[model samples]
Target: MMKKADVGDKTKTFHKGQAIYKEGQSSGEAYIITQGAVGLYRLAGNKRVTLALLRPGQIFGEMGVITGEKRTSEALALDYTEVIVLDQTLLHTLLLKSPRPVQIITSYLVERVRALNALVPERSSSNTFASVCSVILLAWRAAARSGPKSEAAQISTVELSRTIKDILLITQTEIDEVLEKLARVHIVDIVDVKGTYYRTDPLLGTKKKSGEFVKERLLSIPDAERFARVSRNMAQDNPDANGAELEFIDLDDFARAVDAQPETILKKIAYGEVPPALFHFHKRQALAFAASKGQDYFQRAKRPRLKVEDLQNVDDVVGVDNATLEEALSRLGFYKVGVLAALAGDEARQKIYANLSKKIASVVREEVQRMPEPDPGEASDIEDELIGLIKSIKGISG
Candidate 1:
């Protein structure tokens, strides 16, 4: 019987055939087999393809641990085993804290790779076409994860070739050959001259839209009506509903309440009718759905109505101090005494003058453009008068 040595730090016992780590899972830690054997394998051709077997004093999962790559193989314990699990975070800290550990890890990985190569020769030539196909499939999955469905499903062979070449250090000719084999097997549907491939059927190699593929394609539509309907429905089902309820506001009610032009709301909703079941219609859902349609239902509903008191308040003018008035006028651009007097009388003076100033700025800009240079004397007089008018408006003699 082999004596089991206790590697006290980060060691855990696993039952026979128990999964230690799975492929494609986030690599949070690396493991060193201490007391038992472990098998590394990947799913290939619907069969478990054994990649390697590890005994005591062997390090595995370093590829993903170092590069932050996804795990490429599943590790299963051969029997009751004790393994040392090193935390990736701690490992990184250790690498930074001491250079020696980093050097040791790097050399260890190199030695492991060389040893593995002696057993399994780099997988460069064996079934090169199949490997290429695998690369394409990986690319497709990656694109689907990152981009819109329609974009992901309709990948060009040229693009796939470029990506494969970059990632796998393979030739375009090899990628092309693999693509042809993939197309021949019907794992991917190839569009002639366009180089587009769609995963039609997984097993029979039939070209068919996957559920996710269908959903993604539908969502990619500029105006997805199904999404809108579902969104609207979802909004209506909520109990603590704000503004007008969705059920209360029918198609006609929505149009009238919003005061939109004839057929505008109807036409917008009509465009979203293609996949009605796909969306959950709710308030937020409706808003998001109608966003592309340029409808502002919530904004219209939330618009506060002006009252008589509000108007009266604007008309009622209270005397403002000269310094305050002068500063406001200087910053805001008011020149004529008459204009200031009119503004002072109106309680909505700020609002009115703001609008007037905008117009004045536009006119001044045009005049400046027409004139080669402004008259210094005229400019000085205008400035003085502007200041005086501001002071007077505020009822200050200065």
Candidate 2:
């Protein structure tokens, strides 16, 4: 067990010779022995190998629970046993409530544990690629926030790793591999610098430096989006590889998935963008049934979304604060939905997403997905109306 922490009210009992949980079962909790003893074992062929016998006050299954991986070993009651179960939710709450220092240390420790338990089978490559994408994008975003945004952003590897590990259990090696891959493709440059003020110390009881530490690796990303796109192509090429996970918001794929040419998807996206497979299947079904009514039947149609610049007078709303827009939406009550609906397409959605909360964006997105395919003329009219409404707001510039 990582910490002999307080146990929640959840507990389970098993009689002597009873199996508590089998190896390869879905992992859900870290159990603290309360009474009697429990034996941890692994199976090799027909043989059952004893790993450890945990007594009262001891804990097991923390590895699987922390990594969110399946159980690697079976647990059996050596005698009548009772164990306190620290389920995932409770564990998360405990970690989340901890002080910043504790949280940071816990993150590092968790990463190490995950690395140690590498023998345990892991998740799909698509998931790893997603993580890689998130780390890179987040690192780039962090650099942008710290200073003026630039075409090439320099990010501290240590800071980036720490920040990402605090939220995700991805190991440093995984992240390094992603960056290295990006560097290989000329998407980023991993440089080593000396005498820089950035701290590169590992959190191991060392005194904090006052904005002065040696710089090990500084990541320079010329374009985060291109880096992300290349990552997508890498993941698509080898999705099951263990190295990286990428966040995918691919424009071209989305276009193809919706059964439209890239150019057609450029117009005005209708539904909330969905999973590639599911969206493709639904589009196929719709085209199959709806083709008879259309004059040109054989050509499959693609759902569309308009680029922000393509929207009528989109420049008028480009930098407007979301709160101001929300207030405007309230004023134009009838056009409020259409106002949000106009925020479609990769570039347009990026603008909205950058300035708004995900909850509000999701609400807007869900509504758009449910609406019928938008009329281009109506969409332009909605955009025009929305822009006019926004320009009327006081203290707004551009």
Candidate 3:
């Protein structure tokens, strides 16, 4: 029998979907699941392929510990979970002292290796294609938060097709045909960046709209009405029914949105990692589904919140005198989300004045742009404000 090695007070807790370590990360530690479940996954193109679900008492990251190699797969919490971290050096010393654990670890490694090999190419081509699509959708959703310049916005049709081809072992022509069909249905937008011919070569860059673009495209599709009806029905059947209007999309549609296989999503729902609202076999609400799962899962743990009463002095929090803090607050506005205006350079001061002036001008322009004749009084007022703003910028910069 193998004896459990004590790794010391190195236990850690993680929330659902929080990554223990990402693929390609350095691995000096293996983990013993003390409670909850962990998912082992690999990035296949943009989609996460689930390798295994590790239950409590199972050990993972052992391959890295033994081989001293970089992690090949990512480990994520399936739920609120705790694990005992075993560092490689400590584990090696323990194994040297104890023979039983080595035998047990060897057997475990062999089993896991076999399981992984079997899982790699077990699914049919169609399923593989669907999985690829789901990954693309997830990437888009992630990229959406960062605005237009994000990677999702820049993904080309060629890149997407190649990903599908690689996963499903299909020809470029077949992948293109599939994309064309998806585009016809408005599930995907095949964009030609600057009138360039869109070809299915991985190197040729193109643009595709994801996130809000996909959401809007769905509304325009003929299938959306059917999805809406299914959503309504599912809402009615839900045990946790609420009166508030909710958006719903079918599993197939949701799969299309996220570029994932419907079955993969079903598995996640079963694991309780995904909310039940997303599992209405007929319809899954895309936005709500995303919010419920994405917000809690994707969001990094926030900084420890501080209450005013918890601090002996308010200055303790900011590490500044009251006078300095007050001055900064007044200059930067109440939110203090960005840099303080008082501390900003000449360029920033100029931008602040320009922004204020432009805002004033914009309101004045909107009110008068529609007028057959410009309002002289409003135009004069706008000019005065602009001139004053310029003067303020010059004075401040000096």
Best by TM-score: 3
Per-residue alpha-carbon lDDT of candidate 1 for residues 193-275, written as tens digits (9 for 90 to 100):
42334575768978864333212211011222332343334333432211111111234334556787535654344334236
Tell me, by lDDT, which candidate is best. Answer: 2
Estimate the lDDT of model 1: 0.52
Q: What's the distance in Å from true for residue 159, model 1?
A: 28
Question: Model 2, range 130-169, lDDT digits (tens) per residue?
Answer: 5556556755755665577555568788877875554345
lDDT values for all models: 0.52, 0.63, 0.52
TM-score of 1: 0.27
Query: Which regions of candidate 2 are displaced past 4 Å?
Result: 1-130, 196-214, 241-398
lDDT of 3 at 68: 73
Which candidate would rank higher by TM-score, 1 or 3?
3
Error of 2 at 277 (Å): 24
Error of 1 at 283 (Å): 39
Give per-candidate clash totals: 19, 16, 6
Name the regions of candidate 1 deviating beyond 4 angstroms. 1-8, 93-398
